[model samples]
Target: MSHPVILFEGVGKKFRRSLKADLLYGFQDASRSLFRRKPLEHLRSDEFWALRDISFTAGAGECIGIIGPNGAGKSTLLKLVNGDYRPDRGRIAMRGRIKSLIRLGTGLQPMLTGRENIYIQCAQLGLDKRATDATLDEIVAFAGLEKTLDAPVRHYSDGMYARLEFSIATCLPTDILLVDEVLAVGDIAFQIRCLERLDSLKCNGTTVLFVSHSEMTIRHVADHCLLLFDGEALAFGETDKVFLKYYQSIGYLDRQLKPLGTSPEIPADFAGVASIRALAVKGQENAGGVKVFTGQPVDFEVSYFASVPVDSAGLVLQFWNQADILIATTHSDTDGHRLSLKPDGGRLRLALPFLSLIPGIYRVAGGFVSAGDWLGYGGHLLTLVVAQKQGQAYEGLISIEAKVSNAE
Candidate 1:
């Protein structure tokens, strides 16, 4: 069998906290090398490991997502892979040519025009004048910077600069690509274009290392994922399992249900009006939360207590992803379904024929509204774990049923 495109064996990288310590260590290491003495293998007093014992491999046409919180060495790992930094320990092997979309405008000269900078970047990528000329129009069109092509890069906005940089970097394909959160730079349309470009490159057998905090984006692109925490590889494997571990690590899955009306979104007038006592999924044994496969039936039974009689109270269920982004909302009033709750309390069941949510963890919050006035709100009342159906793959926040057929 052919070799993997990229491989890492017990890789580690360290850095000093202060410039003084860095300079001192650099001098010491230089002297050790000159004298042929053994270099230090452990962390010094003022130094710490930015990454440690990171071992993984990427075969051709695979995209490995690197995810973690801030200061988790996600960027550091990409820099190492891009040859911008040398590891203090272990080994990294890479085959064929490499290209990176890490720090988009790093090599750009402020005094140079956008048109001139394109040629410079092409040269840096080892493209000759003829080759650069041939692809120049394509790059300019991709960037959508035709009007500003002759303007100095210093006059360009941050978004314009990023567009130019991304266009130039991705104009050509390479064997391995390292992407580090650069997709979030431009506008939404540009970001979509970038993702399409990445997909095209991957289809052409490019091994990719994609680093992003957006789990949805990671899920959409990566076949495997590497999660880092405090410079250590916490978990590395399939995207679903790794994300589950990530949620568990951050206490997202273990979060206890808070009392109704305790959420900050609950209005002051909503106090003592009505509160959701419990939210459970029908037919689920686990009272803690709900777990179901994509396209599976889901029934959310929300038990609530009302202090006063409400003739027409509507129930609203909001679904938010792990990033606290609201993905979907189902309100009873939207479908002409309103509740007639007694003074004491009652149970409200919101049944769904099919749950079309993509595979991931979601926070389910319930609220009551009557006559356009907020009754009460409950935040994080329940957790919804949507898993992929057996032998099925879906992307984005929701899945839609469709039939495929060939044109006659």
Candidate 2:
């Protein structure tokens, strides 16, 4: 791809669990080097591979998103690229100048005023007085810290520190950028500005390596993605494909729905009146669970038993996201549809011509009510996993159809 701006071949990094082992290994490695002995290639006791055999390439103007669970070596990879840590094995090649927003207040002097720290950081980034002076106002404005620009950085809050750091780092143009979840500290408005700044950088032919846990953000910004699991590269390719693989690797297919809360028991007065037996995706059944893609036709079948005929009954289906927040719900009577259960039990199917849910895990629940009183409630009866539709650009918890047109 036109001479990659960054390349990593078989890169591996290790760390000792304790200070004692670190010192011991440091001395042993130094001794081996002094005696012209080969360096240790295998891990020793109390040592573990933080990253192993990671290889990827990034060309100019491309943003590669690194994602996985915590301790997946995402930050480690960014540090290696930023030269904060050197790989013990393999090689990392880079072209052009690089800037890192890897940590909050990383290069700032806490004892110095924000105004002074700005100059110092700019100098470190290879900007002279005239250059830093030209962009100083812009940076201050972007950080929204003009009133407190003369205050010591130690007095600043986490959000203030993040805003200032991000503004300074991205104020000047560079060939490569490394961001590691630092934008999360800023407010949503600032985060949006940072995304715009990243877009501008990409337009200037900058190669970016971004690490974050928010899949929606990653999907919005990244051209490609790298998935890490337990210090290894599980998948790396197109963002959508990698995300799908990531969900699968994390047991999303086999993940069980957690109970929303204490499920309401059948009231003594209404015992055996009606009960929800099962809730499942009509046509998508597998050993792991139910899975479907975005925009695909879906049918949810709710199985129930009615001990006695119920003249008036209402059925409700709920969809909850991973955070247990209710996203969407449906009721049989909402559209003037009556749900009358006969003495015999049967299954009711709710059909959707096109599912509008975005790709993620969701919990399906069913409830039965008669005349505004709940007869039975079943929560988290089924775990529904929605996958990204190939070549679809929609994101967030749900997808909606919209069109953009020019104003008359």
Candidate 3:
């Protein structure tokens, strides 16, 4: 039987909060190791567990996505897998060559030219001169750095630096790949190229551990997902099921929206000036309904309450796909129709002439802004489902009516 390419068994990592504590712990660990004594497993006053009792496995060619809010130890887990940090406890075992794209400008020398740095990075990755030569043009082309290959990396823009780093890391194939939000660095076109490269790696049987906050990117590439919450493995399983578990446990999909005419639970900071009272969306055909068929019109309404009268307030609504991708955004001020807020609170409705959204679950978020600053905001305030009409075969997140005919 083939062995798993990546395995973690009860892994845990600890870190100190302050530099002084970190230095003290370093000395203590050194002394303990020098004396052949076991290190302390308990947390110190200034230390905390970044990862605790995490366990998972990935077989060859499987792409596993790690997701969580910031400070969830996702980056720490990737660092452990890449051998940059040792687990305080438990075991992590991996076989075959591993390449990581965790940090921007990793393995890059600012003083060296881009072309020279490429060779240095390749050598560090254990690729010999001949191998670097073979892939040199491909890397340069992929990075779109043909014109600036001889320019010093110190002069490269952030986007240029990220593109070069990504190109170098992905120029050659490896048995395992570890990525952490590196794809968010470049422009949209380059991000697409990087994703396509990851797809190519998957097709070529590379085991990948990707860490990102972008749910759409994760859902697109990952077969399995590991969710980390406060340094604990909350869920690990199929991508779809794990995502559902995450959103449900985090109350992302279970928002209990207050009925119309009721004021939102406004915080003190947002109370005096203005606040969002309630939000809702309905189909035009079936008014006040949440479900709608593709190509149908939908009405979005947001109610607001103001302690004092205000002029020229902005109301914005954003539609996010199930994958957490922001599909569309509409602003009331964009069309030069700035809304005025009433002290007693009032509802404003915006209509979409043609929904054009594909069949899928969607989330709506609202924002209320006055005099440039946001007075109040709510996320995941409303959920809407768009279903495909019977006997209709449509593909993709939105439908733009296209007329197709053969010129021949």
TM-score of each: 0.62, 0.63, 0.62
lDDT of each residue in 26-115, candidate 2, tens digit only = 999999989999878777888887887788899999999999889879999999998989998899999999999887887789999999
Which ten-residue region of model 1 has the weakest summed lDDT? Answer: 257-266
List the candidates ranked by lDDT, beginning with the highest. 2, 1, 3
Better of 1 and 2 by lDDT: 2
Where model 2 places Cα greater than 4 Å from the true spot, the runs are 256-408
Residue pairs of candidate 1 with colliding backbone atoms? none
Candidate 2 overall lDDT versus native: 0.81
Runs in model 1 with CA error above 4 Å?
A: 257-408
Preferred candidate (lDDT higher): 2 or 3: 2
Task: Give the best candidate by TM-score.
Answer: 2
**Candidate 3 lDDT by residue in tens digits, 1-408:** 168899899898988889999999999999999999988877777887788778889987789999877887899999999999999989999999988888888678999999999999999889999999999999999999999999999999888988999899888788999998988868889988988998998888899999988898999889888877657675677787667656643445534322342223332334447676766664222111145557777777667788788887888777766445565667778888887888888887888877776655567776777666777766766766554443353444457866799898
Candidate 3 wrong stretches, greater than 4 Å: 257-408
Q: Candidate 1 clash total?
A: 0
Candidate 3 lDDT (Cα, 0 to 1): 0.78
Best by lDDT: 2
